[model samples]
Target chain A: MSTVVDQPVARAARRRPGALSLGLSRGALELKQFARTRPYLIFTLLFPVLIVLIFGAAFHGDAGGGVSWTQYFVTGMIASGLLATGFQNLAIQIPIERSRGVLKRLVGTPMPRSAYFIGKIVMVLVVSAISTAILLAMAVAFYGLALPDTATKWFTFAWVSLLGVTACTLLGIAYSSLARTGRAAPSMTTPVALVLQFISGVFFVYTGLPGWMQQIAAFFPLKWIAQGLRSVFLPEEFAAREVAHSWELGRVALVLAAWCVAGLILCLLTFRWTDKD
Target chain B: MKTLIRIFRRERAIVDAVTENLAISVRGLRKAYGRTVAVDGLDLAIPRGEVFALLGPNGAGKTTTVEILEGFRRADGGEVRVLGTDPRNATPAWRSRVGIVLQSTGEFEELTVAEVVHHFARYYAGADDPDKVIDRVGLTEKRDARAEKLSGGQKRRLDVALGIIGRPELLFLDEPTTGFDPEARREFWGLIRDLAAAGTTILLTTHYLDEAEALADRVGVIARGRMVALATPAELGDRRNAMATVSWQGPNGPESERTNAPTAVVAALAERFGGEVPGLTVTRPTLEDVYLAMIDKNAISKEEAA
Candidate 1:
């Protein structure tokens, strides 16, 4: 029974595909899976838009600096949408995948581990972009919100969204380690997400927030995300109504950039494919 | 003891000469979870194209040992190799040559059977045709069905399809048929035999003694994180040479005797009866009986040591 064939030579001759192409393929599969999950669609994409409409209806007067409450809330909704799709979604989804053995199975495969993350990051980007576009459309149709008048302001919007999404996605991956099971994931993550929104002026006026609350929100990316978006969507004089007394675009870029770095570090330190022994 | 020493020396000599023919090799493997020793100084060697079964009770370190070989966990101390490469230093090429049918996986409820298989195929450089692999596992009729909708046996077949799609030289089956019905188990055994015939080195871990006896070319019994016995199923614990029990219907009722020469005993009984021995039967210790004896003896010896 020693009919051992020397298959190593033959198998080694075959070439492995590059990680980037495989990552893209994984991304496509992730999108297909996401589309079929109804709960993810309803909560991640539509739930924030629903909140924006309710808040828009409740506050009819101008918030300050001639920016109507609806417009102010629209900008806040975009920031909140990015956080929900990137942070909230991934924090819950990674734990669920780990609990279901998906991540452990992938760990044993020949697939590059980086490709898995790339696929997830790609999914978050696509979902965030779609939700952002929907919020923008709703703002235009219902709130009489004006588009950014210059390419520079559009550039600001692009960087802010990209930085905010990247930071939140990394943080989500890190936080998923705290959830031991899929059943516990939502209960663990939702409260933190809600607290960030409440404190970061997503559901209220930033200038009206108390000093201690404003100071606390300054440490997080969501605050900077909303402030940056407001700079793009609101008139130039609207800066006076901001707590900073200026647009503070430089500080916004700096704070969000810092979060991206911190989040990546945390993800590297805490990420796991399975429960600890 | 002499035969064991000779066998050990022969295996050690082979290890020094050519490791290419050995699909898996481990020496002095050790692992611990805090103070609990999971695997302690265990050694194993499997030659190429052999189906070897690891039999043990739950928490006997079977999972710890397999996980170490699969590179899912690091060993505290040992030399381990799979497919001629250290799993600790395993590369993508090394990973591509090995397949693992995990004890439980594929909750791909949203994806169809074909989609799940096709998706996994992309990870391997020398993958088999997904459709043909699916058909080989006897899931052709349910190729388009969602994974969650498949019955337990069908789900296991899908797991097998994914395990073989990579055309692995060595495959690890971790309790592959734990939940299978009798008929499904027979079918799964046939699949294993086919894979073995195709020259795939298979390492099977199972709690079922019959499963090990049916599929494994050689079985290794593990107790308390140590390999207590290694032999072919029929020869384990010297069962083939053990005395047989001959039972017959006597004038009183029934009678039986244990003897090394059962044929002579039967002949004598036949002469006394002037024809045939009524209800005569002969039996030897079954594999299960021998396995339980071995485990029980190991436990008693450990108690004595303590």
Candidate 2:
């Protein structure tokens, strides 16, 4: 008996996998699970496409400068796609996972909490990229929107995505703690995402909104993300219609970066492995 | 006298070994939620390689005490050492040594059983072979099936597979056989026995007296947040020495007698019949009988205190 008891203790002295590697492995598993859930995958990817088609058709013609309403709405929907994947999806999913005891089970293992977050972030990044690509394809094929033609414009698109997706994903994780149960998560998360989309210039034109609405939208990451993507999809001359009278690219980076930090802190403070008292 | 002293010295040496190599130790453990006391002044010590069952009625602080030991909840007051480290301060190395099968958990509905097992195996420093673990739990047939497709029994088998995959020295099983069918329960018991035979220190909290009697080396009965009794199944409540019931057919009708001397009573009944006694039978208190009586007494005492 003593010999058997000593066996596991000796095994425990063996090397553990690095957290980063484990996190990446978890990310792959997360992606596989996400892909296998057919309805969730289709709905997540199709939403932005439907938005681009419906709004692009309803609101036609030019909206100042050389950019048409269809082109402008396409960019806005692309930004919303990122939000839908990173923010809306996770805010609802995390609570469901929490209520289901998935988080609790994971916490029971030797895996680090940071690895769990990393895996989630990785999954969101992959899903958001797929969603963005679908929206981009719809923009070019249906709306005749041209792809970004210059190196600088593509650079702008890349950075905006990295910062915006990261910020929204972290904030989604943070907000999930507020949802009490899996049944309540969608109601709690959907409204916030929709309300942000409306106020953040995804639904309506930013310059066309009332000044107070613009001021209110300025405090959130979604507004800056949409604003940043608009600079990429629309022509350079379209920047004149922005609230700042220019793209204000630097401020977009700063605000999104700041929100990323804030989201991380909130996540750290409120995150719980189990919902039980 | 000298021989008796030698036996006493041998027992003392065994006690010293137990003290020096305790797997789990708790003293004056207390926990309260708001104004409600969940666990109150509970003390427990389980020696290494012992399969111990904790039996209690609902709301008896069984789950609270187990969760605190598993480091899922904080104790309001107590000293606890699991694997020689405070559970609150347990490190990844410490977690690696402990496995927990909660009463219920959300399964990865989309992931195949094999995939989920492989994923969790990455978290442990000394995980067993994933294929072998699946085979051991009798899930090899369902290895390719999604978790959502598993029945209740299959899901529990998956849970057990995951619990032991990490090669943990200590395993915590909380009401593991709650929903199992009779045959499934028997099979699960066999698995538990095998793990115990391999020297896993198991802390099992169950409502089943027969399960405790079947697997545990010792059983502790808890009531109102305290350890009411602790002993081997046969000796619990002094059951082995308890009065037995003898019954037989009489000319008047059926008759029975309760006495400590059941064999003598049975012999007298046989002699009176001048042969085999009609409907002759002897009965001793079962583990369930003793367990229920203990719980009933505790309830009566609690009502009196209130």
lDDT of 1 by residue, B1-306 (tens): 999999999997776567767899999999999989989999998998999999887888899999889888889998897887778787887888889888677578778899889989999989888999998998989999988889988898888888888898899998999789999899899999988888899999998999998998889988888888999899999999999999999999999999999999999999999998899999999889899999899889979988
lDDT of 1 by residue, A1-277 (tens): 4465545425535566778878888888888888988887888889988998898878888887788998988899999988888888889989999988888788878999899999988899999999999999999998889999899999999999999899899888888888999889999999988998989988888878899999999999999999999999999999998887887999999998898898889888889987764
Error of 2 at A90 (Å): 1.4
**How high a TM-score does candidate 2 get?**
0.94
User: For each candidate, C-alpha RMSD in Å?
Assistant: 4.7, 5.5
DockQ of candidates 1 onward, in order? 0.56, 0.51
lDDT of 2: 0.88
Residue by residue across A130-202, what tens digits does model 2's lDDT show? 8889888878988878998999999999999999999999999999999989889999999988988898888
What TM-score goes with each of the models?
0.93, 0.94
Strongest candidate by TM-score: 2
Best by DockQ: 1
After superposing candidate 1 on the true structure, give the runs of residues whose Cα lies further than 4 Å from its correct spot. Answer: A2-9, A12-14, B1-16, B248-256, B268-279
Candidate 2 positional error at A241, Å? 1.2
How does residue A17 of candidate 1 score in lDDT?
76
- DockQ of model 1 vs. true complex: 0.56
